[model samples]
Target chain A: MILQLIDIGYLVAVVLFILGIKLMSHPESARKGNSIALAGMILAIVVSFFTPGLNNIALILTAIALGTVGGLYSAKTVQMTAMPQLVSFFNGMGGAAAALIGLVEYGDLPVDDIGKGSVLMASLVIGSVSFSGSLVAMGKLQGVIKDIRVNKILAFLVLGLAIALAVYVLLSGQPKPLLVYGLVALALIYGLLFVYPIGGADMPVVISLLNSLTGVTAATTGLLYDNKVMLMGGILVGSAGLLLTLLMAKAMNRSVSNILFTSFGTAAGPAGSGQDGD
Target chain B: MDAIINYISVNQQEFYIFILAVFVGIEVISKVPTVLHTPLMSGSNALSGVVIVGSIIVLGKTDPANYLALTLGFLAVLLATLNVVGGFAVTNRMLEMFKKKPGKK
Candidate 1:
């Protein structure tokens, strides 16, 4: 069947992704590697339109156009120095997409099928945190949010509140999209509080943490769709993010909390020195 | 007419755009000094943390349809993680070189 050709394209896309990562390991080949990966993504996306029973052509096309235009403009216009901010935004987009998918699936759930509430709720939690946390991370990198210390006890209190809200949502037996939205908003606000207290140098670790959050979101979405690919992909990403975050924390010679609570890389005081404020 | 539109859409516009974007990104990076390349690579490699998360979820899926998908996804994650680690190592090495004393005359 002609539909099988799309599988071949997918195969090529995967190959390109692997090759691109390999090429990117070195300076000379990094450009080619990135291009290869981009090509793979393009190919994969184009082939999606040909998938059998994909009826929402108009909606899908609009989303594609919007994502493409936004991505292209941001990639082209953003400065090299602002790469961290751009990375944060990209990670946020991934999380937001996953969250949207999860929320959609949540809405369509049958009344008798509230069995996997914990997994679904976990997805919501991680997705919300990633979306808002990435934004706050971006703000820290951009200096929009000043890097300063917050009361540790206060931070814990807020986190406790988030947990309490999450428990209530899970136990209430009511499907409240507004409540989910509220959780996301609360997470976003809390992200501001969390990342604001962190110094700038710790951005890489924060970014990686957010990356892991996005992965959890993706895996949850995968469960909702009964799609193995999404689940495996999410787990791989999440694990790698955790590993990278740990490595980065080790490199910085700081505990995760120390990185979070103190100004790590803020431009305000002897920025890039990395020797102080630890 | 519909067939023709479909053919052109597939054969002409999308591929051309893809090719153009890739080449342009290549060109922009080419113009920059090679030194920036290592750090940039390190940073981007770090960002590929997303790819790893994406792949692991695929691997963890219990569905049989994703066997090949899971295998390939794991491979991608492996390579990406290697790049992240290797790039960082290279960056740290580069930084250390800056700290070394010059040879005496």
Candidate 2:
């Protein structure tokens, strides 16, 4: 019966999450939205303690503290202009967390359930890349990296290496845990290399992409853990993230690839050049 | 006693932290000027993208009992997307409106 607390808490958390997002639709209600989300997270973490096999209260507390400090510092210190970048950073952290969780689970379960294995591996790779890509995008937005453009050769090299690594992993019958780890590292670096050259004005779109990646990572983690709720939650996040990214692109009248590759809005042309007669 | 202490600590600490974070978020929102309303709304609306993935999962689950949940999730994603896109369009129009000269027309 004690286990029921977790379910109830999860239900409450999901409700709050939904309400929070809804309230966030308007500027006036955004404050409440933030509160609702905070409450949901609290409920989730607390309920997790009651779950069997999750007795590591100290570890969980430490993680929460670390994340809280990071979030608080970002909230306080980040300039309004950098809010989009900060959002990307948060999305990256969420993806990385989910990816790491899946990786750990895969390590624990050495038996090769091919379906779970493939999904977890894909999630880890995509999540790692998303995290690094988000950081690179953030760096560009903050002017920490020099404004540059993606060359065709570099693009081809990144794509080629990523594909080659995936094929190598698939064909190799060995339990290449180390290889998977290496791919994660390489993917992160590739993301950094891939996103850094992109212009600052694309931060909003990049942020949305990272958000989608986080959702995918979460879903993958859920799969690895064989948790239905996690899978459902992750899918919710991932799809929403992708749709938002698409919507943002449309708002700017740019394609997703264009946002990634083309240097749009770096140097402002005449302020109202695109303006049409109303 | 130790368990009691742990429970108390978790509840007290988490509760306070949640309250503080909520206040901080609210303060941040209250400080923004009217000119930033559109951009801020659009930006936050983008956060609702989480709904899309959530709905897809529910819909894909193939459970008849969850039909309502799936439908609601999908609607939430749709509405959220519209809010983000429409917010941006309105902001852009407002910007252009400000840029025009009255006598020149």
Q: TM-scores for all candidates?
A: 0.64, 0.66
Going through the candidates in order, what fraction of the true interface contacts does each contain? 0.00, 0.00
Choose the strongest candidate by lDDT.
Answer: 1
* Stretch of 10 with least lDDT, candidate 2 chain A: A54-63
DockQ of each: 0.03, 0.03
Cα distance off (Å), candidate 2, residue A34 = 2.3
Q: State the TM-score of the second chain for every model.
A: 0.47, 0.44
* Sequence-dependent TM-score of model 2: 0.66
Q: Tell me how far the alpha carbon of residue A42 in candidate 1 is from the true structure, in angstroms, after superposition.
A: 3.0
How well does candidate 1 score on lDDT at residue A184?
60
* lDDT at position A67, candidate 1: 45
